[model samples]
Target: MTARSSSAHVAEVEGVRVDTRHWIGGRRVASDATFTDVSPIDEQSIADVHAGGQAEVDAAVTAAREAFGTWAAMPVKQRADILRAVADGVDARRDDLAMVETRDNGSLLRSHLRGVMPRVAMNFRYFADLAEQISHPIDEIRGHRQRVSYDPAGVVAVITPWNAPLMLATWRIGPALAAGNTVVLKPPEWAPLTASLLADIANDAGLPAGVFNVVQGSGARAGAPLTRHPGINRLSFTGSVPTAGVIAEAAAKNIVPLSFELGGKSALLVLDDADLDLAVTLAVEQFDNAGQVCLGAFRVLVHESLHDEFLQRVLASASALVQGDPRDEATDVSALVSRPHFERVRGFVERALADGARAVLGGGPNDDLGGLYFRPTILVDARPGSEILTEEVFGPVLTVQTFATEEEGIALANDTRFGLAATLVTGDPERAERVSARLNAGTVWVNCFFVRDLGAPFGGNGKSGIGREGGAWSFDFYCDVKNTVFAPHGWHAVEGGGDS
Candidate 1:
């Protein structure tokens, strides 16, 4: 059968009964390990995906190792060229990928965040450009000349989460392979569709066999072994704090370098001088993807001076969002990752409501869409210590707290254990700058909530994450530094022999 550019055009595999499955190597591999992919909107099987236990994981590692020699040794420009092809391939099949991702993980549209495409290209191009930028420069250190160079870390294991699977997965993949390191990626089981699509793109782009391999499975069976693999060099993970800890511990057992991007309950400040309209827009936008984002602004701290007005406006905006099927072109909101997640958010809201917090706008789930839909609920008077404030709810629920003074606002914002990203809607330059610095996050925005470019270096400061993964330095996490010392002049052996 011929390859198709759209999901609509994908020729149905003969006798293939599942809509969801794993892509290992160049095809939909049947594995002894298997799990069913269920839609979050309704707890129903979309397809049976490959569980990809140790055998498949070992095959991926071996394949990556075999490909490393040639792929890593290729000229940086050549690598960049292949990445460009990958970007184009992703674009060519944008709709197809978007449908798969939306169906599996509930993404808005594949094309909207097709930043995955350009990001991979840019990531590769950035490192490709670095090849020329990094030159042997004679440096005199205390009267001695020295030189330094960067080398690949050999084999890397990338463990990505469900949210933003394509984008985040590429963020890890592009840089790792570009840095001359081979990679074995384990995408979240919830979103194997995007992983499968990316595997297809890699093959279409003609990536060297095994330069980048993806094994489909969960964190326990697939993730633990890869992280603890004796042959693996580094482990890069994006998930929650608890999981990150487990991966870190396992990597530590092997003495492998680990890059972890953990949980976050980021804060969004609605300063007194802020424009209410702008704040409302950003607040709603931040809740996109149902606030299942690592850098999501969960706590909306409004200055008490504007507390009444801000709460009223935000509640209005939240009420206006139509939560339903993600496939609907007009649906502004979609269901959470699963029924348990929806139930979990409901529980958090219930606890907050009982703790003197009042839900002025939305509190209950919309059972109309089969209970998978939860209204974009907002709570007022939620204290800092509440689970809604500290823990990563990772749902559409937003906790609104009031601050009487800028000091209170700053304190409340910094109260969380996370330092991923923060948003402040303020017109005052002085105040914005102050808030930006004291926010304690890796990235901050004034009048902006959740937007970033492909070139930005992004990571967390505290338990949020370790190391960044967006710019040329992104490769640093996946690479090793090597230095070679050589004699500037030929040895005096001949002259000494003559003298002797």
Candidate 2:
């Protein structure tokens, strides 16, 4: 229940000791086995978390299943009020939560406090208001009066990734709760601190026991069981594609619906008519979280006319970014989540160089700052078909490629298997509209990058993901739609009663 200030360099959170346990039903629960949580910033032990396996998953799912009816049956106004309180609770403890997340995931404290923390509360508020405004519409068809209603999808297994842990978790949890489904969240072991804190906040907000639960551990030990559990009616996962496939297979066994927000090798197309300054600004912004974001512009497809100019601008921006301790407010790029991930990202750059791609700026790790730090790299002259251009390198690396014509640019943008998100920078509104339609991505940004509206749908197409997760789309995903038909009493079927 405690965290260090943003200025502290050590991983120690004051009151949170070793043996941090799971939050099941309404209270803390422990397991025999435990795993150590190491800080990405310093590679120091943060805490020893109870490693919840199938036994813990069973307890959490059972609790959620038991609580579903009561939570679903609660008055809409009451649910809205509870959600509002949860939002307020997050706002009240914003600094602490942000510090915990910074320690857990090595994200910049400035970004966490200024960008992420506010969105955490905003997400809850959005769903809270939506709960009150939601309505069931009626329709008349073929002489039958039909009313369509939405019901909770029962117990939902919310599995979140390490990067942007709480924000992404809330993306599913908020809508799922607002839709009246009980949630058993399984946060990534690497970054479970903030999520655990969130559960505590929800409890303080008077969220009933068993209505929300949190199980902490790795994917195989905790996530697999949660996904395979037959008691779970739906699964919402935001992580890598391979892990998502495993979850999808397990959910399929139980015929449970799933919403997968998987990885992305998204493209940012800089058209010939683009504003060079704005394009470069957006490109740097895409790499804000050290390029750990799912919607990051991994592949930069610039029109041949502006390719050289764009590369020059981007290189300057990437090189000027400060890389140091995440605790420091001035640090622009922090460490990767772990040493393994650091090596993986380093390997991507090395392999690209070995395969004949040239480095425009940084080419490898930054041992100067210590910890799992990688210099923000820009790989140029990368072939379109190469792994560097096609795969999801979740790091501060940008691959630049050129296209001759508009047709070629669009084609190159959609060349990859991932269709999560794409950005187009152009001055012409007509060209923006025309190219956006052909991009083949779930969300397309025009003239800007990462511009999001909570009311709009947010998800991917193709291998990027399966379903949407925002606004009405999120509510629909977490709820089951049922059609009720009403028949008139003593109604004889008159000839042509319904004007077919």
TM-score of each: 0.90, 0.95
Off by over 4 Å in 2: 1-19, 489-500
lDDT at position 411, candidate 1? 94
Worst 10 residues of 2 by lDDT: 1-10
lDDT string, candidate 1, 1-500, tens digits? 21222332132221222233445444555667567667675655566667777877788888888878888889877887787788778777666666666767775653344544455455545655655455655555433345766688888898888877877887777778777888888988887667776777788898877777878888788887888787788888999888888888878887998888886889899988999999888877766887788888878888888888777777777778877777677787888887767788889889989888888767878767764777777777876587778888888878888889888899989997899989998999988887788889988978876678656888898889888876655756777875544434654332222211
Poorly placed runs, candidate 1 (over 4 Å): 1-28, 110-138, 142-144, 484-487, 491-500
Ten consecutive residues with minimal summed lDDT in candidate 1?
Answer: 8-17
lDDT of 2 by residue, 207-296 (tens): 999999999999999999999999999899998899888888889999999898888999989999999999898888866778899999
Among all candidates shown, the one with the greatest TM-score:
2
Best by lDDT: 2
RMSD of 1: 5.0
The TM-score, computed over Cα atoms with residue i paired to residue i, of candidate 1 is 0.90
| Candidate 2 accuracy as lDDT | 0.87
